[model samples]
Target: MKRFCFTAVSLLVVPVTILVAGPAGNGECIRTPKGDITIHIINHATFALGWSNLTIYVDPVGPQARFAHLAKPDLVLITDIHADHLSVDTIREIITDKTLFVVPPAVAEQLAQPLCQRSTVMTNGQAATVLGIKIEAVPMYNTTRQRLQYHPKGRGNGYVLTLADTRIYISGDTEDIPEMRALKDIDIAFVCMNLPYTMTVEQAASAVREFKPRIVYPYHCRGSDLEKFKALVGTDLGIDVRLRDWYNK
Candidate 1:
């Protein structure tokens, strides 16, 4: 009986150690009042959202990206035709017959052949439901006069995904637009802040503060000061500013 007891304890110890040492896959699963969400940051402006097995890839790019390890996406959303946002090669590599492609009109126009068949076009303010998730296309554009032509309003989109009562905003590539500030009841937000195309760190923080998402992940901030973002959200509004390794090796 004592031998059997020792053997049982040894088996439990091995499993526990493996669990403790295992790679904490992708991003942590966040439990909000609405539902559970797992965010996988792939690089600047690229991420995968997993709610159950229905994975959603947003702005997938990066030549070295490996989707083999990731859950097969039921739907993929491309905000624009920018190289960082929509790479035809990358999309072709990851797309399966079951995958549904969602994109703005500008991106839709660029699609060819079979890809066009699976594509859904959405302009600003339009809404569509795919794979049990409701997607609202919000305006994403440059307000700066010099950069106005980069992303004209109504040409690109920032998506608002409503999944199981949770409202998640993905600011594709935009400045601190009025629509962003006007948003309410946002559970999670993935806001972008980079120079030449989108808002600065200050602008991103200000917009986030106005909307007051329960949690905000500062993504697509390639050449911006992310520390400033954390400092801006420090201890006031109770907004959780999560920092993931979306950049660097």
Candidate 2:
């Protein structure tokens, strides 16, 4: 097991600054009624959450060393069967006997036997509690006619996790569809924005404005302009736009 030592740094507005050793530089902490939920950014479309002595890895992909600093996950969530979002090799390297999984049916179909046995297949609008966290699978797909072939509806899922009553949303490869715009009471959201794969920054921003999560992180953004996304969201809405280094190697 890898051990981590965290030092608290000072940020003017937020009370805490997370300094940890890893490829994923600094972490952002969300103070919840129970404790702090630490977000460790691994790379595009991948992140790890630390809360309540358990680690939750979201769409874990890439080399095993990329996650060396983090603990083996108590739970892993696979959103889709796409290469970036699901990797059997990476999962095999990190999981232990106790690791649980929540995956979409499409993703579950692709998992190896051991992993499939540990997974709970959830479709859009399905809700279940795993490892003390309430997970609701939300629909994720493309709306534009040209992009329909990329991510067909009902094939993938966007996840909403309720941790200590703090609701978090992770948009797993999607466009700004009605489901995204209809989300309510979302505390934190990780939205995706790219070229033909997902919606543009403008479309992403427009959807965010409508749903109005308290904190929004523009993740899964490979080549999009994050500053423009932030500018479009603006401060008038009182949404905290956190720009993290999700593409760093």
Candidate 3:
């Protein structure tokens, strides 16, 4: 994968090799009239996004080795208090003084004072602007009775980021809740699925089918059958199911 090379002042796009080439590299980028957003799929639920001059890390967890090659984050977004999504050790290793942590209230309550002091807490239906990008906190929870304890309502957050005209939805550990199915005009969506923890592949596909994001990438899915997900929501429905290697070798 090529390095994310762009200048905020110049807005110059380097050669096609710059950021994941034409959907054939580590990730993809969308160039809109206002700016560009490049997505880097790290591991698990962790992802690094390059938008203009800012580097945004979402649900970043795991070892420091997983993120050695990337730029230091300008902003970090934590969706839940789960260890997989929010790691204080990992945060200590990657964050700088300027890196602001964006999290929901549930996550805020669980974080230590050092983290909370620098964190911006947003609740469901709340919006905030960080690094000139609009971020809205959406609720993520389990609608299924048995799985309710795994993720109760208002405990975690799914997020919608508006970059130029593009809207990217990041589904933090959740089932097929009404909030997810009710989203509108999502250009890119990162959805989670697995047994016992989140939704099944069928549930993930069903939510994606209803929302109809232009492109959908299934992440945080270890044991779930992605092939079945693709078949269930075929291209005929006009939704592109993008399969990425979210788990390590």
lDDT (10s digit) by residue, model 3, range 99-154: 88788877777667766776777777877766777778888998888898999888
Taking every candidate in turn, the Cα RMSD to the unseen true structure, in Å, is 14.3, 8.9, 8.1
What TM-score do all the candidates reach, one by one? 0.87, 0.89, 0.88
Off by over 4 Å in 2: 1-26
Q: Candidate order by lDDT, highest to lowest? A: 2, 3, 1
**Winner on TM-score (2 vs 3):** 2
TM-score of model 3 vs. true structure: 0.88
* Tens digits of lDDT, candidate 2, 86-163: 999999999999898988878877877777777877888777778878888889999899999989999998998888
Candidate 1 residues 1-249, lDDT tens each?
111100000110000000011233665676644445777778888998887568899988866455666877889999988898988888878878888877887887777756766766777877777777777888999999988989988888898887776778899999999999998778789999888889899999999999998889999888888989889877689888887778773
Model 2 whole-model lDDT (C-alpha atoms): 0.85
lDDT of 3: 0.81
Which candidate comes out best when scored by lDDT? 2
Candidates in order have lDDT scores of 0.79, 0.85, 0.81
Clashing pairs counted in every model:
0, 0, 0
- Name the 10 consecutive residues with the lowest summed lDDT in model 1: 10-19
lDDT score of residue 225 within candidate 3: 98
Which parts of model 1 have CA positions greater than 4 angstroms off?
Answer: 1-24, 32-35
